[model samples]
Target: MGQMRRRGTVAAGIAALVVPLTAALGGATPAQAATSCTAGVGPYQKQAEKFLGRPVDGKQSSTDCTSIRAFQSKHGITPAAGYAGSVTWGVMNLMNQQKAAGKTPNKAGTCPVNKGRIACVDLTRQLSWIQDGKKLVYGPVPVRTGRDKYETRTGLKKIYWRHKDHVSSLYDVPMPYSQFFDGGQAFHSVGVSMWNPPGSHGCVNMTKTDASKYWSLLKTGDDVFVYGRKPGT
Candidate 1:
């Protein structure tokens, strides 16, 4: 993803997070925002793939449903079971943001190991992992990602801090590992995601259990890998 050609200035609409590319959506004609499961699905799926690092035909996985539910929970939204809905749109919006940031999932799935420790994100599969020496840890958590061309970043990153049971807004958003990248993208956990892969605003969301587990195991500068639909070998 490269610097998006903005048609207008981006505005802060939803979440406190705002980027320039989002400006295009803000000015999109009503007809453009309207999504049809037919074509709109592609943009959503494509953006998700950018994060997953592989083509995960959103229609081919139950994880898609699980991911949508997770999105609903994040924004104080309730998730419905089965089928993509309005909530899914919001998730897509987040994914689009990554593209705005010039971090779409490219073809090469190679995230360098920086300083002997690496925190990598795989956009196509929507998964994140941690590596320490030869040890690898994984979690198939829900994420609210950036849009089509705007996807979560993938590269050698680092974990700079950890927050346990951190309070966010009205929810106790627990960040297991706060990996320092651009600004505030952390690896955390929440109490949602009915077992699907929702998008994240760059931040990685783990299960409540995994958040706590990683909280104890993860350390600053430890290697982290964000790839796959689920954390795996």
Candidate 2:
């Protein structure tokens, strides 16, 4: 599976998915002021400072705000207001765990290795990747999956449809690079940060770049294995 484009016939007559009114729209909550660092010390200021390698003083300094804000912005933490609250702190913790995984994200052997070409989604860590046997094909990029009641269904499935430029019939939001692997719970690129809270209605949300890469790399019938439970949901 050396980057070969395997074209397969698309499944026709698949019902257009209508997600819940709460959140099928990918860009429903865009962080507009992600760059503006606020002026106050957050509840987790000291923890954030330590995580960012800044001074361990509990007070919020200008430099600390800027650094914490940068981390929040980079990870798509909401408000992006430079506050080191629990959400920001939680994301920092996740990043630390992922960093420890390094190049071999599948070291835990959760994802099936025998599948020729498969998409591996680790909902527990909110990360995804493409693999060709033992070779890592695409990324172990950060992702946003379904929230609470609409949790992304786990188990092995195959890509049944591919809609490069898709708009939700119900939500009317753009779902770019949409590839339906499990009913309405497709893999699509959204406009918000992958770390955005409460997650999607059911879809696996990816960044624009990551979704585009997946669209180019995978095709209908490709294996998609979603495992583990998302942190909150």
Candidate 3:
């Protein structure tokens, strides 16, 4: 009788564990599960895929969203949460439209200088590019320029200094991958939303990824041109 009771107790315990395990297994999908973006095959997807070096199949598959997020991360888009929503689509569309119009995809009118390697900042377009004469090296990359009160100075300048890991003496903030051009202003990586309203304070903010790339492509004394006004000015 005692043996029978022990067996029954063990069976009950095993059943309880099994029941909860089964329930958990049947619960909602894991957070790491593949995410399917619903934006579908459209202009946004087409351009995004092209930008991401993916096949332009016009399908918003899980792979597409992943590639879009990768691009977002490179260009300073906030969240980089793998969703090609309004901001992502808007930027991509603008780039595509510009390309279709036979203009430099990210050029704000024209190249500020017509010479050697230069970093071009078009505040009007909130985009930056690195070019060697007329040959494009990188960009039309989304950037955040200074806000209204502390507007980024517009004119031709040159990168006079560079700091792989710099800290602002006035702002008391870290400025990584900093390349100073005008006064205390610089082009550096900032952890803020590039698409949002309130902008930076006399600085050209880029994504960490872009900043790193810029560091590699530019050197001290490289020409830096700040022109045009930011969109929605």
CA lDDT, every model vs. true structure: 0.43, 0.75, 0.66
Q: What's the C-alpha lDDT at position 219 in model 2?
A: 96
Model 2, 102-135: lDDT tens digits are 5577888889989899999998877788898988
Give each model a TM-score: 0.42, 0.76, 0.57
Candidate 1 structure quality by residue, lDDT tens digits, 1-233: 01222221111122222222224235443244333112324335544443334356665244443343333333444433323444455445544443343322322435543334344555554434444333333332234344334345555455665555454542344444343444466766655542234345556665555555556656776765544432221
TM-score between candidate 2 and the true structure: 0.76
User: How well is each residue in 65-165 modelled by candidate 3, as lDDT tens digits?
Assistant: 65565555544666665566666766555444333423264344476546689888877667777888777677556677887788999988999999988
Q: Which has the higher lDDT value, candidate number 1 or candidate number 2?
A: 2
If ranked by TM-score, best first, what sequence of candidates would result?
2, 3, 1
- Candidate 1 regions exceeding 4 Å error are 1-109, 113-117, 133-151, 169-181, 194-198, 223-233
State how far residue 196 of model 2 sits from its true place (Å): 2.1
